[model samples]
Target chain A: MNIGILLKEGPYNHQASDTAYKFAEAAIKKGHTIDAVFFYNDGVNNSTGNMEPPQDDRHIGNRWVGLCQKNNVKMMVCIAAAKRRGINDDVLIDCGEITGLGNLTDIAIRNDRLVTFGD
Target chain B: MEEFDDDEIVKKIMHVMRNAPHGTIYTYEGLEMILIMAAYDQDISVAFVDDGVYALKKGQDTAGIEVKGFAKTFLALDGYDVEKLYVDQVSLEERGLTEDDLVVDVEVISSAEIGKMMTEQDVVIQH
Candidate 1:
């Protein structure tokens, strides 16, 4: 199955990012394809590469990048939503690509399921 | 509210509105999404709850704020064939508003009714 995950909350403040990551990992382990992980609203903050949490904490941003690299999944941040939150290409993670709503529509149409994780 | 069967071919996509407009981009962008989905002709429904009920209040003057006022866009949603706007009755009453205060016509139903409708959707996108 091809799944499109929409993460609509920011990191740390909510468990949405953690939940999305676990779900994606589990789906990939089950041999399901994660067609795309689209970030909207505050969720676009996950694309920021400059996050500096405590050394003991998990590098949430890098985790998303690693997931995309390992699974060859598209990590998309809604350009409009990102812009509103001051997240741009300069700050986006290595695997993150800024996209539009049309791409989300395509993901929803092409994928067998569209699951969203939000606060 | 339209009913669907177990074998229905139509995809039910519900756009959830949970925040106030202008203060944050969620409601505005959610509306943008619904507009695009309107062209897709999918079965779409929007539920306004919590602080989201403020998006439909009448006589919103944003001249001081300088942002583009989009409350009027709710009035045009019907033209896009994106009807089925559900407003939570508890949210409205708690906010001291009634159907007459909203800019557009919406079915003010209980949260229980809306919750049941949510479980029936193929996809629920919250903003």
Candidate 2:
């Protein structure tokens, strides 16, 4: 199975992020394939690289990054949302480079299920 | 050119609505089955909108119910190559939410644009 996990919200705001990751992990465990992890809208924060959860808490961003790395999943962040939130692979700020809808189109063309997590 | 199934050619966009407590889940679940079948057999697209967006919410706590992980099953859609996920901008705003509130990166479009997208598609399934 090939899966596309779309993350729109941040780590703490909703269960979408965790839910998507859980799906991804379970799919891989079950020998499924993950096509891409597209991060659009607030979902871009998944790759902000500046998220800091307490030491005892789960570092969702890191976990996601690690999961993608382990599974060789294509992790895509919405350029627009990333820029709006100042999220980048290396840091987070008030403003940064933006992602475009075209990127989403590209992913849509290749993957099977474009699962979204938002509220 | 190769022939296509008329029923399969129609692009069906399934909007997953898990927020509503009652009959909504069944509605969305039915839509999910349809989308999965369409995408698995043909080409179909789905968008998760509004509070319905959380239907794909991660870390789903379905402890009380015996329902299989609907969100988890979503990750398997790629096997069918159905990969279009869109969210409504107005819905998010109306709920005092921004992209940051969702779990995945989804295409955020306005109501007008959503309507337009719907028209272009062969089918639109909202739960």
Candidate 3:
């Protein structure tokens, strides 16, 4: 199955991003192809390159980057939502790219399932 | 935006609003996303459940609260060709609201019917 994920909350403050990451990892392990992970609302915070978490805690942003890299999945952040929360190309993680909602529409159309993880 | 190919599939995308307006940015930003996707010519629908039904309540005034009220935006959705709107009947009655109190005309149906409809959708986005 080809699945797309929509994450709508930030890291640490909410479990949304963590759940989305874990879901993606599990999906890939189950032999399903992850189409993309599209970030909207506070979800864009998951793509920030400036996050510096403690040594013991999970690094949410880097986790997403690593997952996308290992699995060849696209990570997208809504440009409108990203700008509203101060997320831009300069601050974006290497695996994530800022895009318009049209990409989300395409993801919905192209994937077998478009799952949302949010508040 | 580029035109969709004739052979392209038109997915049924439903945006479920479960939060009240103004208390959070979910409903407002969700509306913004709906407007953008509307132009893509997909099969789109909006469902108002729980506190989401309050987003369409008539006579909303955000003047004193300083937040720009977008209750009227629901009415403008028709202009974008997003005409399929559903309101949960139980949610409406629970909140002491009726179809007459909403800013737009929506199909007031039971949550079960909406749940069945949701199962048929290719994508369901809730805010």
Candidate 4:
């Protein structure tokens, strides 16, 4: 199965980003191909390289970068939403690429499933 | 950016508005997404439920709230070829509103009906 994920909430403040990561990891383990993870709303915050959690805590942004790198999945943040929240290329993680909503529509069309994780 | 191909499959995408227009940016950003998606020539529909019903109510003046009012933007959706707009009947009555209270035309339907429609959609994005 080729699945696309739409994540719409920020990390730490909401459990949405965490659950989305777990779901993607489990899906990959089950032999499914993750087509892409498109972040909108505060979900773009998950692409920030500036985040520094406690050594004992999970680093949400790094987790996404690592997962996408290991599995060869595309990580996209909506350009319009990103700009509204001050997320630009300078602060974006390596795995995250700023894109447009048309890509989201394309993701919906090409993927077998388009799942949303948000408030 | 990749150009949208006319040969690509047209998706049935529904944007579900579940929040009030103000006090948060969800509804506003959701609208921005819809406007962009509409240009792709996909089949798009919008459902206003919960406090989202208030977004379509007539005479929204944001001057006092200090936020730019986007209520009129809903009216311009038709120009983008996005004409399928649904309003929750129960939500309207609960808020002491009717179809007449809305600034734009929308089909007033029951939540169950909307649920059935949602199942038919390829992508249902809720805000």
TM-score for each candidate, following the candidate numbering? 0.86, 0.50, 0.96, 0.96
lDDT of 2 by residue, B12-83 (tens): 444444353223344334344444354334445566565666655556766577654566565565555666
Question: Over the stretch B62-102, how does candidate 4's per-residue lDDT look in tens digits?
Answer: 99989999999999999999999999999999999999999
Ranking by DockQ: 3, 4, 1, 2
Listed models, DockQ each: 0.50, 0.02, 0.87, 0.76
| Residue A60, candidate 3: C-alpha displacement in angstroms | 0.7
Measured with C-alpha atoms, the lDDT of residue B73 in candidate 1 is 97
On a 0 to 1 DockQ scale, where is model 2? 0.02
Scanning candidate 3 chain B in windows of ten residues, the lowest lDDT window is: B1-10
Candidate 3: global Cα-lDDT? 0.93
| Model 3, C-alpha of A117: deviation from truth (Å) | 0.4
Question: What are the per-residue Cα lDDT tens digits for candidate 3 across B1-127?
Answer: 1235776677788999999998899999999999999998888999999999999999999999999999999999999999999999999999999999999999999999999999988889998
Q: Which stretches of candidate 1 lie over 4 Å from their true place?
A: B1-10, B64-67
Relative to the unseen true structure, what is the C-alpha lDDT of residue B6 in candidate 3, on a scale of 0 to 100?
75
Residue ranges of candidate 2 with Cα displaced over 4 Å:
A89-99, B1-127
Rank order by TM-score, top first?
A: 3, 4, 1, 2
Residue A42: error of model 3 in Å?
A: 0.7
True-structure RMSD for candidate 4: 2.9
C-alpha lDDT of residue A10 in model 3: 92
For candidate 1, the docking band is medium
